[model samples]
Target: MTSAPPTTEPWAAPHARGPVQAAVSLPGSKSLTNRALVLAALAEGPSVVRRALRSRDTLLMAGALTALGARVETATDDWTVEPAPLVGGGSVDCGLAGTVTRFVPPVAGLADGPVAFDGDPGMRTRPVGEVLTALRALGVRIDGDRLPFTVHGTGSLRGGRVVLDASGSSQFVSALLLAGARFEEGLDLLHDGKALPSQPHIDMTVAMLRGHGVEVDDGEPARWRVAPGPILAVDQSIEPDLSNAAAFLALAATTGGRVTVRDWPAQTTQAGDAIRDLLGRMGCSVLRDELGLTVTGSDRIKGIDVDLHEVGELTPVVAALCALADGPSYLRGIAHIRGHETDRIAALATELRGLGADVTELADGLELRPATLHGGLFRSYADHRMAHAAAVLGSAVEGVRVDDVAATSKTFPDFPAVWSALLDAR
Candidate 1:
C-alpha cells in the first residue's frame, strides 16, 4: 500500500465563525465493515455487506481476503463476499491499519500456500507479535512474529487451547476468535493478560460470529470457546461509525452548537458507541431520536473524569474536548492507546500543549487542565485520529492548521468535504 499522503503543506482547519448547526451523515463503521468482510469470506456461501466502508482500511481488508482466494466484489452499491477454498501464495499490504495486520494472519493460516504480510514503515513498529506468536503455538508455521512476516498456510489449522496476554491490544483476541471456528479443532482460547482493553470489540466479534451461526461461548471473562462449524452466509448491515462521529460531535461541543449523526444504532459493540454517555458527561446534551443521535452543546463545556478502557479509540477526540473544557479533566484507563497509530497520549498532550492547554501525559492516560488557547500548526504524525483531534480544536481555536490532513483517508476519505458541508449548512 502507498504511504500516507505527503505532508509538505498543512491544511487550514476550518475555524467556526459562530455556533455551527448541521446534520452530519457519517459512513459505515470501519470496525463492523472489516469484521464483516472477514466473517463473510469464511462463510459457507456468498454473503453481502451493506453500507460497508470503502476507505483505505476496509479496502485493504478486502484485498487481503482476495489475496487469500476469497472473491470480494466492491461495488458502488454494496460489497459482496464469496467464500473460496483459501489458498495463499500471495502478499498482503496492510497499510497502516491495525485491523488488517492483526486480523488477517490467522485466516491466512487456514489457506494452502504461504502468505506474506507487510505494511508502511510505521506499521512495522505496531504491536502484532502477540497474535503471531499465538498462531505459532496453535500449529501454524509462521516466519516472523510481527508485521513483515509470512504465514505458511497448510490448508488447515489445528486450532485448540492457546493462551496469551492480550493486554497490548484487543485486536489480538478478536483476530484469533474471528478465524477460530474455521480451524479443524475449532479453538479454546484464553487470555492470561492484564485487563483487556476494548471488551466491546470482542463482544462485537462474538455477536457477529453467532449471527453467522458459529457457536462462541464467551460466558466467562478472558476465555472463549468456538465450536467447529460452518459460518452461515448472511447479509450484514453496518452501523454508522460512531468513533468518526465523535469528531463532529466535538465540533458542536466546543462551538456551543448542535450536530446530529444519522442512523445511530440503539445497540452495538463498537467502542465508538461510548460517545453518547461520554459526551453527555462532558456537558453536552446527547439525544437519540428518530433523526438519529444529536448533541447539543451547553453554554460551557464541562471537564470530566472518565475511564475509557473499553473505548480507547475515542481518546483523541475526547482529549480535544477536554483541552477546551471549563475545568480540569482526567482521562484514564487507556494507556494501550499509546501503541496505536502513534503515541496517542503523547501526541494529544503535545498538540494540546502547543495550542496552549495545560496537559499532562500519564503512563496510563492523560490529564488535561483547561487553559487559554491560541492557533498554531498541529502535526498529525500520519495518524487519522490525531488529525481529527486537531480539527476539533481548530473549530474553536483559530488558525489551527493540521499537517497531513489526508491521513484521515485511512478511514474517512471524505472527511474534509463532509466536514465543510456540515459547517457550510449553517
Candidate 2:
C-alpha cells in the first residue's frame, strides 16, 4: 500500500534479442511469508521468519498484523514477530492482496475491538463473503459480507462446526483454520459445494499449523478440524517463490534460451511448483542440479492442453507463452481466476487479442491459437501477475509497451530490474 506513485507513461519492455542465460535468485514466497506472519502473530512467543519476501502485499500483511497488536521487527528479509495481545478498534488496508483480505479476519476475530477491513477499489469485487458469513456461523460478531467490512471482536470466537462452499477460493478455509486453534471450542470446517481451487495452499496452512504444534485433522476430503491448543513459535526459512519463477522460465521457453532459478526446493506444497511440469510440457528442457533448477527452451515452443486449476496464479504467464506457441492451447480448470486481482481470463484474452493472437474465452479457461504477434501497448490491469505476463511477451515481441510497470511490486518489487539483469547476462 506504500508503493510509489505510478508513471503516466507506459514502459517500453526490453526485448530479448537472443538466448538469455542467467542464474536468477528470487525472493521468498509471498504465500509462505504472509502465512508465517499470521501464525507468528498468534503463536505462544516470538518467532523469526528468515528471508521473507518484502513486497507490497507482504508489507500490507505486516502492517495489518501491527494494527491488530503484533510487534513485527524487520531487517532486510528477516522478520522477528513478537506476539502481543490481540486488540481491536483499528483499520486494515487489504490492498488488493488476497492473503490480506482472506487471512486477516480470523485473526481479527480474536481481538477486543472493531477491526475495519477495506482494500483497493478492485478488492471490492474479490470474494470475502464466505469467510465473513462463516465467522458469523461460528458465533463471531461480523458486519458486512465483503471487503469494506468490519469484524466486531469480543476477545474470543465461539468456534465449532461450520459448513460453507469454498469453491470460489481456498483462502476461506485456510483463513478460518489459521486461527481455529485459538477459538474457544476450536473449529470444524467442512466444504459442502464444488471442489476447492489451490488445494496446496490449504495444505500449506495445515502444515504450518502442525509445525506450530496445533493439531489439525485434514485426513478427510473437504473437512478440516483444528483442536483448541497453544500455537508454538518457531524459527523458519521460506522457499523461493516458484510462481514468479514461472515468468522468468517462460522467457527461456519463448526465446530458446536457458534460465536457472536458484534455491528451487526439491519438494514443496507451493502451487507454483507445478510450473516445472507446465513448462516441460511446453517443450522446455527442465533439470535440477547443484546449480539449482534450469530450464532450456526448445527450438520451437509447442502448445499445450492443460488444467491449471490448482496453480491458477501461473495462468497469465502460461497464457502469454501459449500466445507465442506453434499451435493451439487449451488452458482449463481456472474459472476461479476471474475473481483474482482482476478478471485475469478476460484481461489475458483481451491483451492477447490486441497483440494479434487468436484467443477465445471459455467459461473455465481460454483456447489460444498461435498468430503472428505485433507490438502493442499491454496494460497490467494493476495485477502483478498480469505485469509479469506482459514482460514475458515483451521479451519476444518488439515494441511491446507495458503500462503501470510499478504494479509488479505487489509481490516481486524488483521484477523489472531482475528481468533486465537476466537479459543482460546474455
Q: In model 2, what lDDT does residue 361 have?
A: 96
Each model's backbone clash number: 0, 0
Q: What is the per-residue lDDT of model 2 for residues 1-426, given as tens digits with 9 covering 90 to 100?
A: 122235558888899889988788999999999999999999999999999999999999999999999999876678999999999989999998999999999899899999999998888888899999998888778878887999999898889999989999999899999999999899999999987999999999999999999999999989999999899999999999989899988888878999999989988889999999988999999998876789999888889999998999999999999999999999999999998888889989998899998999999999999899999988888888988999999999999998889898999889888887777777
- Superposed Cα deviation of residue 197, candidate 1 (Å): 0.3
**TM-scores for every candidate against the unseen true structure:** 0.98, 0.98
Residue 127, candidate 1: Cα error in Å is: 0.5
lDDT for each of the candidates? 0.90, 0.91
Which 10 successive residues of model 2 have the least lDDT summed? 1-10
- lDDT score at residue 368, model 1, on the 0-100 scale: 85
lDDT for 78 (candidate 1): 86
lDDT per residue, candidate 1, 1-426, as tens digits?
123455558888888888889887889999999999999999999989998988999999999999999999997648999999998889999999999999999999999989999998879888999998899999888998677899999999988999989999999999999999999899999999799999999999999999999999998889999999898999988899889999998877988899988888887788897899988998889999888999999888899999999999999999999989989999999989888988888888888899899998899999988799999988887899999999998888889998889999989999988887766666
